[model samples]
Target: MNMSPKSFLFLFLFLFSLAFTYGQEGLPRLRISENQRFMITEDCEPFFWMADTAWELFHRCDREEAAFYLKKRAEQGFNVVQAVALAEIDGLQSPNPYGETPLIGLDPRQPNPAYFSHVDKVVEMAAAEGIYIALLPTWGDKVFTHSWGKGPEVFTEENARSFGKWIGNRYKDQSNIIWVIGGDRNPREGTSDVAIWRALAAGIVEGTGGQDKALMTFHPQPAGPGGSSNWFHNDEWLDFNMHQTGHCANQPTYQKISYDYNLQPVKPTLDGEPLYEDHPNCFNAKELGYSLPEDIRRIMYWNVFAGAFGQTYGCHDVWQMYTTDREGINGPLRPWKVALDLPMANQMKHLKNLMLSRPFLTRIPAPEMIPANQEDNTDFVIATRDSEGSYAMVYFPTGQSKAVNCKPLNSRLLKVTWYDPRTGNQIDAGIISKAPSNTFVPPSSGGKGHDWVLILDAV
Candidate 1:
């Protein structure tokens, strides 16, 4: 029988839709190099750091909620998510809030296969969005115990290895997974805990088919750098260094921590967990309230400029919240849910693009490059340059007006532009004088202020 014209058109449209959907499903694999660098097949070098802090995974929530959060993260230009396997609040044995799906019993020493299956789905979904997963096995689970999960007793070398093997085998082939070992805290006895972590690292290496190992790091307690300084800092198993800045909102102190990490000899370092939304500032409790967008930007740019390869952004309530329902388990999702849409996310994207645009064979921060005028203030400045002198980027953030001077490559002929980081807009041509000094005036606005990016190119 001959098909009518209308019928033929409908059939063609349906086939076309399927092809489009299939094309969208394709995603890149994320893997780590021997040097501990995060390697992606796509040219994501000068890697733009787009990350979010969804620290809770394997919580009371279902796989569906995890997928929703991961998908939402990708939509907002977040290519990386920092999450824990045995969620701090919920563990493998935690009750399933959804009565429809009953919890299965599994040895707590080994990862619950059911929970990891959920993790696999989340990782797969993130991969489809070009997002990578920074998977942490347990959140201080090895050292501490609370309502979340059994710990201390679970912090044995054998158990760590078994847990690592289970996880590594599950996603061995998936390149988008980054293995993060430590949580927000460290082990009690330094040597034994290090041994346990090493065993786990070995398990991951073996399970991931070895050689092509996953990028690995330890997440230390607040105000600490992954317990690496004494324990795993230079260990062959560690790929990079990660630090938590605690919940302090003081911009100056937070930025300094980044500067110090930049000086480490290892591959690269980053602030894995910084101050979260609604967290009280340690320095001043009543003076500075929580969830200020400017405070977030200050910490982010400071970390990036100070030689950190990436930064993680998070909200307090969201980081701690887990749910079985669509409406989110925490408080009404008004201000907290909307926090992701804030200016900080867009600003980081713009900076990532700028960094990737330049050819950076080597980047060295020039502390001496900062001018005397800029040195006396609380504002933090970090400068880095490519080897050939073709490109350079400087980030300067000060609560008050400050003049900055830097050594310029061909100062007279360099093309300089000041970037308003808030909107990612560039100001018209500004020149660096032959004397190699430029004056930058911080916005007159008090405490909550703006940062500036100075891009210089040899004309």
Candidate 2:
């Protein structure tokens, strides 16, 4: 078989094209609806996105370990994991803690193919487990530098745009990748960080192949509200809103801010970053250490009931601990594997499934339906009803037993049931009178310290 030179060249080109396309298999290309809904792909329902912080993914361990952690998170019902491309700890720039692979090139300013290869593997593994990665390019590297890697002068507007473009192209077809742009640092108070942010976002949108436009949002510093107000809130590129309720547990303040954002005009919103593991409880001014199961559950339910689309969870070890050895770091370092196994994961799964099972849970608003009395600050309650008016959910956060009045709810035949969120137990159920209003006395003390959910169904 004597083949001509031209024919051989043509054959080589054809094979190369085939290989290029085939290599991209399993890459996620997400699509959003015209109305801004997260297009459900491959039967992926819009269940509440229960998430965890994996800030150590690239800095602490290798690809294999990253996969192991991500898989465990999926098994435990965490659908999303938040991570930073350039971490806050030192020694991550080159020749990582593991000693075999380098984090970046000798010139930290230039892009390293080897480093991105490791990241690609991690993103691919997460997609395999039906888990999405909230990819953050850098931490608050612009404003502060810690033991983690230092930020290149790339923090400037010109460099940020270039960085965003590079990042977008690298992960272009990855469907499971969610682009989160900001770290804890905000643009200089009155400066044009806004212009820099917008430019970066523009580059990301451009680089991400039209195949799947990644959902975009910003991660503001703790206590700062996420959205256009701070940085790129109203930016046309942003698809959703995210807020950090401070590192300390400021439940009341978080509730107030969340309530306000829920009423915002733009797209779906969430508390992307809240208190971390073992952080102090600002309300009580006590060092609670890591977030306990009850604390996670309370925060999650509180956010959802207050009209947040999703809640992001964090752990002290996972957020601040970079190395597997957990040495040289000032914070706690519980193995993320153990953190995933915590009872809080199971609780989140059960509660989220129950809420989604009812349609009314999605349609109601936080302000119109839920009532919080200023005189009795402890009298905060959040309520939601199904679209068909068949069912309603009410969450009471105050530990003390209090009366919840529902005057707007009018149904001839109403049935009230109390359920324990932790155990999924039906504590009690009974018929109620058709009065002008109804008062619900939640079980004060129970499996968890939080008040119980009162489920009302029309008979």
Candidate 3:
């Protein structure tokens, strides 16, 4: 690797600073709040999980490329990055950029240190940038070998636990690590898949010192209702629930979030994978076409409004780390480097800021604030408010006019403002008295790309 003297100095200082920061105390460790509805920083501040999907980061990117990706994402305000270790694209046999496969002789017990050293450096680099590695030890195909994945199915129940233990122990002290199991596959009944996954969870808990030492969850393929909760809600190790709304648009993902929210033995829920920016809509490019920025923004707001803790954003090209030299999946519009700055990629921070702008920790779904059957249409509105009735936020998909029931907010006048999701700008919508119902309309409304968020704060 050729470098100027200044570049070498920067790397030295970056490493030195991180070594000091983590040596004293790592990046603020996370924990499920006492309410069990959200995550909190070590100091107990609400954690808004703005994450990006980089499934192939470790598998595809070299050190310099990985650093570039992490810097861009950190600048975009993403605190978590979902990536894999035993990657999905023929990872076990295929060597990483360093010419080292993850396992030696396809043996789970014999992990290749050279490859894992690269993984360690990437994790450390992410830690330096204050980003949590939502690390998956292995993709699901390594366990089940599903229809699409190129897996040789190397893990048995015993080896799965052993591998999980080894990996968990390796990163046990990294404060920015969050163990995410199950890479895009759900367990089938009557098979050992469920037991194998459970054993992996137990192994992580044991290796990481104990259950409290780790914040963990499962990432499943797009499933019907409760996603991860459908399988692991009752499991003691699952700290939260994750759903993949999949590569489709106009999905009422909030309904799925609401289902998980209302489930007994409450656990925080989030859409780990929504429609990627440039993905073939529903995997059918000819008929449905590619996903637009508007399509992904709707899913993000809907998940947050309907009681999700927080959610992740993905780009089809970025997840696969596609370049001109590589084969694009489902017609990638651009290379991963160019896809990094795609319009919606920067727009995601707006939602995160809007949620944190007010008292968001106590917030809950405010469906009563919107009219009945509004969700029946694609251009529907969704609302959420502080559990204390202090503030409310409503997302207007097409910026439509609606009679919002402000009475549910509180018996007081409220200060309202229009939040532009596209630009992160706010326009005052004037104050209104709390009445039986109130009509609020956005400045513009016609079709796709005309979305608005109404912010209501009690004055």
Candidate 4:
């Protein structure tokens, strides 16, 4: 049967509209909580943004490999995957597994549709797995190329906006998309970096319709004091704040989390990058050695107890999808598939469950409850509580018994328990008297692996 050209055009347009509609309506869009401290779903449900860094997902993995990674992470209770469109490991020069580069002639404004089609497929696959894609439009190298990244330094203030708008439009309808700007590079004051990122953000807002269209944040390179907030915290487009915190052990990262939490203009914050499961601690394998699972577990507890809404877990190997055939970032021990089951990845759910087990929305940082000097201690004791004083948790890094100021808590009778962050087990420690201050000994003590969280549930 012969078909009319007009009929073909009409059919194509109709199918495209259907796809666009599904993209928008398929997942619940995330929004900032009313308290401006956490993420909530479109239906007003608490959303714990447990994410895994898969910076090389689109660059290295084919469709099958990408899906496999998503399935595994979703099962591990990660609701978000932090990935990149233009990856960091020489992404512009090297083609993807499909032999397609993201841009035509390394020009940000002239994105190659063929290359982006793979990115589209990866994001769609993530959505299908009930996962949000925390997408970086381009890695930091593409922007600053400051110290390490290979530079052809392709982005400018003008093209940054154009690229941002185009990429934003392509995924405007995909509900699971969370735009993360500035990649891993921090914008300097004197340079055009800030202007370019702002332009890019403006383009995204334009493409997606408005500032309220999606959740947005920046990923910074462990720049202390404020991290992303050092620059963009006051910006309208930034929905939350994130910090890398680098890959060192005994970092006292809770200090960073608490700093952001108490900023003049409050915005939600979390550790975008913490010490990875097996990264060379301080990037010195010869001396400090690879990070243990305990290193990551402590950092996670430290950040959350200090008032981070959620945590992002990473394994040095898995983020790059390391395989025997490829060169490693920092001496990866296993392939990405094996790295998926690394202790911290599976154990991350325990933190998610612990947070959700409590009264989530009402929680606030209780730094005053912890001894001021302990704030900088490697055996750091940190605390958080229901803003209403309904419940509280204090983490003992190395399980050191410390006197906690109990006067601030309104509860007269408190039921205390020792929560093992490593095992997700809560052991009863009997009722406690609420007074000006109290000393509670942790069930386990004396080293890094002996971490415990003292939980107080008030009647």
Candidate 4 — which pairs collide? none
TM-score of 1: 0.82
Question: Each model's number of backbone clashes?
Answer: 2, 17, 0, 0
Instruction: Evaluate all candidate structures by whole-model CA lDDT and list the values in order.
Output: 0.62, 0.64, 0.91, 0.89
Give per-model TM-scores: 0.82, 0.81, 0.95, 0.92
- Model 3, position 147: C-alpha lDDT score: 84
lDDT of 1: 0.62
Q: What's the residue-level lDDT of 34 in candidate 4?
A: 91
Candidate number of the best TM-score: 3
lDDT by residue (78-158, candidate 4, tens digit) is 999999998998899899998999889989989999988999888888987789999999898898898786755988989
Residue 257 of model 1: what lDDT?
46
- Per-residue lDDT of 409 in model 1: 61
lDDT at 158 for candidate 4?
94
Question: Best to worst by TM-score, what's the order?
Answer: 3, 4, 1, 2
